[model samples]
Target: MRIALCALLLTGLLVFPGVLPNSPGHLGSLAETALPWFGLGVPLLLVWAAVRRSVKEVTCVLVPAVAWVALFWPGIVDFGGRDLGRADFRVLTVNVGGDRTAPRDVARRVRATDADVVALEKVPGPAMHAYEKELGGRYPHHAVGDTLGLWSRYPLRGVEKLDLGGAWPHAVRAVARTPVGDTAVYAVRLPSVRVGLGKGFTVQERDASAARLARRVADDGTPRVVLLGDLNGSLRDRGLAPLARELRSAHRQAGEGLGFTWPAAFPLVRLDHVLVRGLDATGSTVLPDLGSDHRPVVTGLRAAR
Candidate 1:
């Protein structure tokens, strides 16, 4: 009976996480954000069944194990195929946090990626000058709006601030003229979410901001678009479903492993993403830490002609 109950609990969390209540605490959203980690319970259950010497319990354990594999196996495997030729462009995005020291070092590390485009968020106003100075030589074209910034090796045009229902601008949009063609790029930093003993999961502001951002992206006329930012929530979180439906996550398409990028010292969840549309993602990876709370994500893309 203990094994049966354990199996049911694991399966329910894996397959029906959405059914969990969101009020008081946003349990459902939290489950979805940490969904992949829940697979760890499968082995524990299997061990318990083995000790009990019950074949029935062992079979029950297989139920959740299968469900976990079916849901996340694709993300774990690298099925991006062999040698998709050279990537037309590479993009990198990172939330540099509010660190006052070593901003230059951070800029140097990011520059070493050799990405055609770079997006940075949570950059304090004063540190902007430092980044501009360090990145200016490599990326001649750039734009900065509030804490969000975009730097490109290609010429950038139509630079503008995006209002995602925030008091200050936290998003920016620009067009980059690359050899392949023009592509619209967005640099965004959605509102942060908090979970406290008293408040539970506080994501109301982030959810509203995500909705506004989704609407703006939908209205955009550009056929090719690349969104780079710290979304503050993973793709599995319902708050991001609107944008998730509109864009394809580069990591999911080409990356191996879970690609967690937050709390850089001991990464636990993926808060940064490189999402695209009208482009083929050839490769995606999380870069080494650069003195920030969040790590950087890089993706290789080719125009989907």
Candidate 2:
């Protein structure tokens, strides 16, 4: 029992972040979420062993539990969402649940935030027309790929359709010329989560999209890049490892707590995100709901200038 407890703590330490395979960041992430519980549990185990008068067993459990808490507790702090400076440019990314009824609400709410650029997902078929009518004049530069779209208040270049195959927005790439500078924004929506012994997502589309986005960010030579949308996987999940490597999560820079953004009625985990690399993340945060199951993540950034 003592040896097993030590091994559990050791394994979780080694499996974090870049240490493990890229395909399963979530379960690896579970180490972060579940370890505290283990910390709480190990102490209980120590008491039991102590009651048995096995000081050796109690020592084994107590040491690791105390060490584990001390080592990984910093990760528990909310590193996402920071404060924006005067030079920082801002962007808002949200999944509005494809409901046309909220088009006006979406536009009004987003515009009110005074965000310089906006990237929206789950743009409904019915809402597309209304969205265009409401935002077209205001946001002259934009990119739309079926369900996904990017609307900017600035002049945009290299607008193209992002094909996220199989009814899910696996990927798309665009260049946004913000007042701060030009940034390549890759809007992606990965396969939904399904935990099982079997492989959950085929990952063909997800991987392909990730590869393409990574390639673009790598070769584009821009000092800044933003990948935003309903990635379907948390920043810690292995599914987003490829993407995670190339970009830093916006929320991690400024958000508080888990900042969960899914199942809007009662969000338990953050599924929507905005990741950036080569750009200095000034701040990141979640926006209130406007009829979408996924809450929006807003980020403010500044490039090396």
Candidate 3:
């Protein structure tokens, strides 16, 4: 029984979600999203093996244990602080929760990072004025559309709304003329996903939106590009494969730990991301909560010459 359990856990960790059936609530995608958590089973199985005094079972536990370490140990290690000072610029992205009442506080905490660029999502219509008032002095060049906004210290031009096949504007693109060069910055908020008894993990809509966003990014001719926003899905999930194929995640490149940034109180999973192309990620950090449901993700980047 212990051997069987270990084998199952190993298969789940090693198998790509695409190979598994996605029907009945996107089971494959759901498993992939929480992939790292599967390691918990290792401890539980070990305890069970001890209780049963089964030598074979105890040895079998090593299978999943090795697999988990091989798959996730690198991402969990800290390897970023040293290169942070070399970064050319810093960018921050956060989903300030539509219902947040402290826009000024949010803006203040974000500004404290001194990020060269800031991307905000889910800004309530009424609170827009507060954000502008608080962040305008620091980030003079800014753009706002629908629920998404971008603020930059550098001059911004060619600001446009991207059509992600959504009725309301959920993405905006602009060019920031930085000291390094012109970098296309995209502030995006992908559709949210939910899991219910009836629907296992409803991610179809989010996947479709991701496909559209990927196409838009692919079409852009800009050599340096930075994408910041609440992706609503982790990089491990297959739904984000479209964007994952073309861009590199800043956290995976330079962040320490798993970098979870949601449910500000406990942050179990990372729904926010800073993805870049034609640039190197020097460092990444998840900032403290500033009265928003989601914590902000800041990444230091250096434009590749």
* Candidate RMSDs in order: 1.6, 4.3, 1.6
| CA lDDT of every candidate | 0.88, 0.67, 0.87
Alpha-carbon shift of residue 112 in model 3 (angstroms): 0.9
Superposed model 3: Cα runs more than 4 Å off: 11-15, 80-82
* TM-score, cand. 2: 0.77
lDDT, candidate 1, equals: 0.88
- Please give, for residues 49-154, the per-residue lDDT of candidate 1 as tens digits: 9999999999999999999999889767876561223689889998988873377888788878889999999989888998899999999999999888999999
10 residues in a row with least lDDT, candidate 3: 9-18
| True lDDT of residue 295, candidate 1 | 90
TM-score to native of every candidate shown = 0.95, 0.77, 0.95
**Candidate 3 lDDT score at position 237:** 91
Of 2 and 3, the candidate ahead on lDDT is 3
What C-alpha lDDT, on a 0 to 100 scale, does residue 106 get in candidate 1?
Answer: 80
